[model samples]
Target: MSRQVSKKAIRDSKRTFGNQIIFWMFKILYIIYYMLV
Candidate 1:
């Protein structure tokens, strides 16, 4: 029971971390795009 819960928690955290990294990548790209315009 506890093992299943921990696995779910870890998966959720990994997903959130991936989303954050993608968000930052897009933000940086946006800034660069505008700078060149």
Candidate 2:
């Protein structure tokens, strides 16, 4: 049970990390778009 919990925590962290990366990427793109406009 403890192992499963740890596995889930790791998976959740990975998902959050991925989301953070995407968020930053989108922000950068938005800034570039505004600059180009």
Candidate 3:
């Protein structure tokens, strides 16, 4: 039971990390677009 809980926590963290990376990528793209405009 404890192992399953830990695995779930790890999975959640990985998903959040991936989302954070994607968010930053979009932010950078937006900035570049603003600069171009």
Candidate 4:
């Protein structure tokens, strides 16, 4: 039971991290696009 909980926690953290990375990437791209235009 503990192992399953840990695994779920790890998966959740990894997903949030991936989302954060994608969010930042889009934010940077948007800033650059605005600057260019």
Candidate 5:
């Protein structure tokens, strides 16, 4: 049971990390565009 819970938590964290990377990538692009403009 504990192993299952830990596995789920790891999966959730991996998803969260992916989302954060995508979010930051967009944010960086926006900043660059704003600076160029």
Candidate 6:
């Protein structure tokens, strides 16, 4: 049970990091679009 919980936590942290990366990518794209306009 403890092992499973640790695995889940790791998976969750990775997912959270992925989401943050995606969010930053979108923000950067938006800034580029604004600059182009």
Q: Go through the candidates in order and give the clash count of each.
A: 0, 0, 0, 0, 0, 0
Candidate 5 wrongly placed segments (more than 4 Å) = none
C-alpha displacement of 9 in model 3, angstroms?
0.2
Q: Kindly list the per-residue Cα lDDT of model 2 for residues 1-37, writing each as its tens digit.
A: 9999999999999999999999999999999999999
User: After superposing candidate 3, which stretches have Cα over 4 Å from the reference?
Assistant: none
**Which candidate achieves the best TM-score against the true structure?**
5
Question: Local distance difference test, per candidate?
Answer: 1.00, 1.00, 1.00, 1.00, 1.00, 1.00
Worst 10 residues of 2 by lDDT: 1-10
Q: State the lDDT of candidate 3 residue by residue for 1-37, as single tens digits.
A: 9999999999999999999999999999999999999
Minimum summed lDDT over a 10-residue window in model 3 is located at 1-10
Q: Can you list the residue pairs that collide in candidate 2?
A: none
Better of 3 and 4 by TM-score: 4
Q: How well does candidate 5 score on lDDT at residue 19?
A: 100
Comparing 1 with 3 on TM-score, the higher-scoring candidate is 1
User: Per-residue CA lDDT of candidate 1, range 1-37, in tens?
Assistant: 9999999999999999999999999999999999999
Q: Which ten residues in a row have the lowest lDDT in candidate 5?
A: 1-10
Model 5 Cα lDDT, one tens digit per residue, 4-28? 9999999999999999999999999
Task: Give one digit per residue, the lDDT tens place, for model 4 in 1-37.
Answer: 9999999999999999999999999999999999999
Model 2, CA-based lDDT? 1.00
In candidate 5, the residue pairs with backbone N, CA or C atoms under 3 Å apart (3 or more residues apart, or in different chains) clash, namely: none
Q: What is the TM-score of each predicted model, taking all chains together? A: 0.88, 0.86, 0.86, 0.91, 0.97, 0.86
Q: Taking the tens digit of each residue's C-alpha lDDT, what string does model 6 give over 1-37? A: 9999999999999999999999999999999999999
Estimate the lDDT of model 6. Answer: 1.00
The positional error of residue 18 in candidate 2, measured at the CA in angstroms, is: 0.6
